[model samples]
Target: MKRRKPRILTLYVTERCQARCSFCRIWEKGNPKDAAPAHFKALLTEARRLFGRIFVDFTGGEPLLYEPLPLLLKQAKEAGLRTSVTTNTKLYRQRAEELKGKIDYLLFSLDGTREYHDQNRGISLYDTVIDSIETARRLGEWPDLLMTVTRENIKMIPHVASIANHYKLIFQINPVFSYFGNTGLTEQDVKMMKEYIAYHKTYVNYAQLRLISRGGNSTLQPSCRAVTSQIVIDPQGRMLLPCYHHALDRLDTEGSLKKAFDSTLRRWYEKRQGTFDFCEGCTINCYFDPSFEYMRNQAALLSLSCRAKYAWLRYVERPIEEAFKNRKRGEL
Candidate 1:
């Protein structure tokens, strides 16, 4: 069998952000430098050549802080790659129109209701986020919501789901990682999350809900595709092999991009075949969700079945239901 190239690339376009979230340490330690646009373009080109089929995500402390983001997105699209961005939605409100055609998906972070969101994100920007969502909708841009579930905001899942439903946007729920200085979820919290996802699976995007419910440090998996099917690159251009959890095993991107990637791949394979102690207990979704074929466990079967059911609902049932409703209103 041929080795599979990474299918996803997360680019930290810049290091500056407006919000000082309670959980994130990025703000506490200030970012004094931003990645150059030329470096970004070069990296994207090499990335495209390495991975024939790729999805590039432009993330940041806040991607909007980078002025050349539009140019970068345009370049990636012209290279025949799909592009996406995850933002806090503060700056997007002003530039959604400019970004409408460039980005395939625009993800907004919505932790909870106004009070909850304001409290968790450590800023009074809930109303601004709402405005940005409305602005994107008005400009005919496809916007989605990402909810980082923590003790402070987990109870507001249903409310946030309703907001996504109201806007007809995709709602993605992810549990807060313990590495971020936040308390990890308890057994009770996990149970509540499972129940909530099951209940609202039909109300929002079924695929995303299913992904979130199955997320976290899953013990049923054999290996991860960190270097094979997914990777995260910091703004300074170093690549994180395996995942962000193993941040120490970073490959410098100062020389030949292909050479660096090959070395990283070798390192990843060695880790997998050798002691393999590092891969003992980790279930980061970015590494697991997209690399399901490598998971020889019961959760893999569950993932497939859940995907099939949701795929049918999203592609077959929802369209028919919408058409019926439209015809009933004499609009179809």
Candidate 2:
């Protein structure tokens, strides 16, 4: 019997965003066209049929702005898929209750401290996002904090980890990818990343060590998974994205997800030496790094260990007051 793929399906419900962040290539212009409810229903049906453990992530300029988000999530859950959303958290509070059971995880994009966050996202967004996260925690939603490490906020890494610890939250540290439309990193920005990596090496390494020691794996690693296990469907339902950055660069559809997985993608992964011009100079976590690891299984053990450690921490060491304080301080 053939092994089923471990697939993650992401839907860009809308392109309408309220914040004008400098780093975002996709949300630079508002996405006026959205996937209608009927189309979404069809996509969900296809997702349920094609993969085992269907994981759905609804994203957008702001997915919450999509009028039928709650309904879409409800349908996904009803189909028995693990559902998540990546949002700026500006509309979290208003939709928390409705999303309580439907969403398995709320991945909030939190950059840094209030001043730093507001500067990167928009005016007062940091506070609003913090408040929304706190509320979600209080309501038992257990949201995960996703920090995109950019040149502007790299210095605050330790502080961010401290906040995650305080909030009893699982943190995903993503190095910012330079894409078209976003200002490419300067020498100073590169320098800042190096400094940030050096400064927080202890905490970052320790956390990773602990995670590995406990058997936790990072979902972000092992990049060929996108070709084999993950499928990103844009607002227009175009499939087989090289990466989110690629998808945003143009809503180009190369082939159906099924065809890609069964044909060219399979050949690339199986052969283990193929390269795409698009893969060069790419830093998007959704692709480049994972491809390298998948080819060699370089960090599998550490990844599994880290995941285990995280589970242990979640069950045994998660704190309450600290969690709230972390949010209040904009550390998370």
Candidate 3:
């Protein structure tokens, strides 16, 4: 077997969020302290040594609350790393110009239409987010949109996709999983989502489309990649061993980050990464998507087939639509 290393790093820079989403646990305990930029730079440096150039996402309860975001973004870019920031877009209207061209991609959160979004997010900032999207467009910034699918908001997926289309931004639908206390979406809901995604693939840019499903165990499973190809670090820079949603034991990173990676805690995770006792057939896209590239077993093939139809539309139909739009606009 070949060894694999981290390809993407998800940094939860802060536990401070602007809105209190009912389905999220960002504010469950209390307002946590934000990590210093130097801490992040160190992580990036170590990560690069282990896994060459990789993609980094600065996520948070609300990353915008981290005052030194611009500095961190600049540092990541200077390190020759591709970077992205995920925010609720509540502060976008105020900091549009400041964050115009800092990162490679900006992801905005939107659960559903104004009413549904406000209801789920526990805040009524939908209008502000829409306004911020406009501000990003005016500044020539194309921001992606993320909508976590829940039972209440499942049917609204297409409506949200329409909104993403209006802004010409990439859109993603991530199914809320049991890890978040069960998103309440049934098998029927997943079916509806598959159908809707296929229909939209004709008009949406495949490069900008994302469809994330629930995680759990089954026969069609691949080796989990939580601590391997994908890693999640909390605000304090402690590694969430095994996976992010369920941290078995926190790996200490106070001294050398590489030491923690090669510690007994990591070895424990590696031994039980894909076993039913540890991850329980989880299917989180960020960790599992890479498995498709090196699929060698029956489980990998089944996993790929489950989402292959939509994947086809995304890769095939999306490019054709993009070409049509470009020609229509005289850009081709």
Candidate 4:
């Protein structure tokens, strides 16, 4: 069998964000240094040559705030790569026309009703997300709702899911990581999460919900597949090793990714990921969700026979998944 190439690229395009969110500290980096469009041009070119098939995500303190995003997205498109963006949608309006056809996937955040959302973000922008979703739909783009769930905003899951359903979009929730400073999700929060995702099986990330419910990224064994199929690039053009969750070190991006990835340092981290002292009880979804995968039928069969949520998935969810794929492919 051939070695698997990294399938996903997450580019942190900028380190400056307008929102002062309670859980994230990226905004405090202020006006930091990072790549210009020329750097991204070179990086994307190397990425395309190194990995025959890749999915590129442009993220940031606020990717929409990055002035050269349009040109960058166009460059990736012309290179024959799929592109995506994860944004708060705060500045989507001003860039909507230019970004319309460029983004292949979009993740818009909605924590809860206006009061809760503004409080969590330390900014006032609940209404902006709603309007941005409408705008994206107009442009033939269906952006999902990604809520950062913590004790402060866990109750918003259903409300956000309703927004996703109303707009015909997927709903993804990520539990707060302990290192980001929250005490981690309480049992109650996890219970509520399990129940919601279980009932809303069709649209929710059912597989991820089940994993996190069992304590995400907390096992001792190397269940993570980061080095095998994913890489996260910071704004300064450095790779976050193992995964961005436990960035033990930053590898230089001054050379071709193929060489950097195949380095002995990369090999060491890949083999030793789940053994670190800090890895004992880690539960960062950014690392776990992307790094985990298995045979679909294996889980489906077990769940169909025993789990209530997946029972329905076996009988009814496949078509729903198919329709979603069709919609994602612009067939519906």
What is the C-alpha lDDT profile of model 4 across 1-332, one tens digit per residue? 57667768888888878898888888877576555777778888889998865889898888988999999999999899889888888899889999988877678988888899988888888999999999987887767688888877766677887887787676667677677676777556778876665225333444445655566554465455666667788877788887776688898786577677788988888777766776766766655555554224443444334344434543466457767888899953
lDDT per residue, candidate 1, 213-261, as tens digits?
Answer: 4443333444455666666788888787656656656777765567777
Q: What is the lDDT of residue 70 in candidate 1?
A: 92
TM-score of 1: 0.84
Scored by lDDT, the top model is 4
What's every prediction's RMSD, in angstroms?
A: 3.8, 7.4, 4.5, 5.2
Residue pairs in candidate 3 whose N, alpha carbon or C atoms collide under 3 angstroms: 215-283, 216-281, 216-282, 217-280, 217-281
Candidate 2 structure lDDT:
0.63
The candidate, 3 or 4, that scores higher on lDDT is: 4
Those runs of model 3 whose alpha carbons end farther than 4 Å from true positions after fitting are: 198-215, 219-223, 276-278, 281-285, 290-294, 297-332
Per-residue lDDT tens digits for candidate 3, residues 1-332, read 66777668888888888787877777665657797788888888777777777888898788898888888877778778879887788887777787777878687888888998888888887887788888887897867787877777767878878888786666766666555665545566666766777324322211112223233444345356556666788888888877777777787666577888788878777766666464664545556665443447654566556456445554565567778988999963
Instruction: Give the per-residue lDDT of model 2 (tens digit) for 168-229.
Output: 67776665655655543344555555455432212122222232233222333223344544
Candidate 2 to truth, TM? 0.74
Whole-model lDDT per candidate: 0.70, 0.63, 0.71, 0.74
